[model samples]
Target: MELGACPKSMRYGPCGGVRTGGGCEVVDEPCPFVGRPLVEWAGTELAPRAIELPRFLVDHRPTGDDRVDRQVLDDYAASGVAVLLGDHLDDPPAVDRVAAAERTVDAGVPTIATITGRDRSTDERAEMIDGLLAAGVAAVLCVTGDHPSARFTAHPDVTFVSEGTLLAGEVRSRGGRVAVAESPAAEPTRQRAARLVEKQRAGADIAVLNHSGPVADVIAFAEQASALGCRLPMYAPVPVMTDLASMAALEQFPGLTIADDAVNAMHTSSDPFSTGLDLAVAMAGELLGSGSIAGVNLSGVATSGGAVERGRVMRRVVDAVTA
Candidate 1:
């Protein structure tokens, strides 16, 4: 059987190239398979996050089902895109983030683990960093993760610097790439923009624009960043809604921007999932055309379609859009 050109190597397979110092021997491109997925993020990626077993998954799926995880990672990795693993939402961070990342690596998929900083401390950051280093992961996407418990909320009176910033600095010292999330949906105030630049200087190697809304807004955010001189490899997540019901539900969730165009298009379609997929593909094309972001993530929210189907559909969209 014949095979297509491998994007990672940009060469003919059966993938005989030896990666020296973690780069392709032929093209000198970074080894797409080694290290954490985010560090190896090219211009596009399929980011599948790990979430706590929701009430939805509790009855339908078993806890700790690594098979689905491995299969999902493998499918995306084969397409020359890195797999980003997300942190579960729990007090004290219930599951081991490093172990979750290790699963991605084990599937031969590069991955980025989400590191939450709110309601946390520096010492805890040190421990998590140690675990990531031990897990052989190379990149991370750190965020001031939402705080329902307020256990680690950063109060203004306390002069709370984000854990993501500290982790970025530490990751830099270790020679691994670090990513910090950016809120492009918010009005780009000088204060917020300046903080992002400072984050880059402090050791953040890249940016993941928080879940975006309209494509115009996303494009505008990129332009705003350019104007602000925030030059970092960046990616924006493509929000997926499997149905109008799901779309309506997300209205209360700030920053999960659903473009007006997308809503109109999806509302008219008999097949909302397919409509959503098309909208995502179109959004990806525009985002890449802007030449601002290095990639796009499929926010990994539960779609009306099952998680596996949503991811698979997004992988197809990434291939078509990025190609």
Candidate 2:
């Protein structure tokens, strides 16, 4: 199968959203790149360059109100946590990511802005990166975003003109720090690390590992990537599930797999919020102590109108881990 067969048009072949049965995430067909050899990076070789960023990172969902967003940035800044400002399919239509990043940076918070190939052309992405860097973002996370699910109403018809591997080099050429994502539990698991190596060669400075399974699995993935000559510092995601709503929201993310034990514990607990918070803290601590990863990303969905509450939960986990 060729790259044209992929709905995302990713030269990197299978993306993180490949189904367990080796099916495409967007179409009713087997993933074309499933059994093929990993596509080697074809871009000019560029060494990964380090950038200063916080050890504790949280996914910030803009509430679409400037005052609320400012207060949230101030809160995270005070807590010594960096905020990842990215465009997700579920983000409110009014949420302007560049403006949000500008506000976060202006507020003296470390901001990692994300750029995806899902809905923008190469020139559009380049311009976006330039705007983000000018706004003083600490780094730019280059990702191949998930295919738009049919459940999203009025989803735009767009093309993925440049995937993360290609975007990494683009970011580097524009003098911006580059962070790329890897899914260890996705199909072609063994090739995942090799893919990271290619990403690093394409100028990725950091790797953010998606929620795969247990902490042990995360560590193993890091080790595998290291053995394959991937030297980029890695950040492991710690799921922030404080309630059933948040848990359900997180489960909607493609290629994410929370351990069954943790899920059961959260479901059976008398106080799910406390149970989930404790579980997140424990997981963060374990990942930090594993000596495999450089940091942890407090990653999950917030219930409707629960962004502030979710931030409090993230703060608690950060405090517990750093204390």
Among these predicted structures, which one has the highest TM-score? 2
**Which tens-of-lDDT digit does each residue in 143-223 have in candidate 1?**
645423222243332222344555566656665667777655432222345556656666666677665577777767766
**Clash counts for all predictions:** 7, 0
Worst 10 residues of 2 by lDDT: 149-158
Native-to-model Cα distance after best TM-score fit, residue 174 in candidate 2, in Å = 0.8
Alpha-carbon runs more than 4 Å astray in model 1: 1-63, 90-94, 119-121, 149-162, 187-191, 245-250
lDDT of 2 at 261: 80
Residue 164, model 2, lDDT: 82
* Index of the highest-lDDT prediction: 2
Q: What do the candidate models score in CA lDDT, each in turn?
A: 0.54, 0.84
Candidate 2 root-mean-square deviation in Å: 1.5
Clashing pairs in 2: none
lDDT (0-100) at residue 91 of candidate 1?
18
**Residue-by-residue lDDT tens digits, candidate 2, 120-215:** 876788788999999999889998888785235457777788888888888999999999999888888888999999999999999888889899
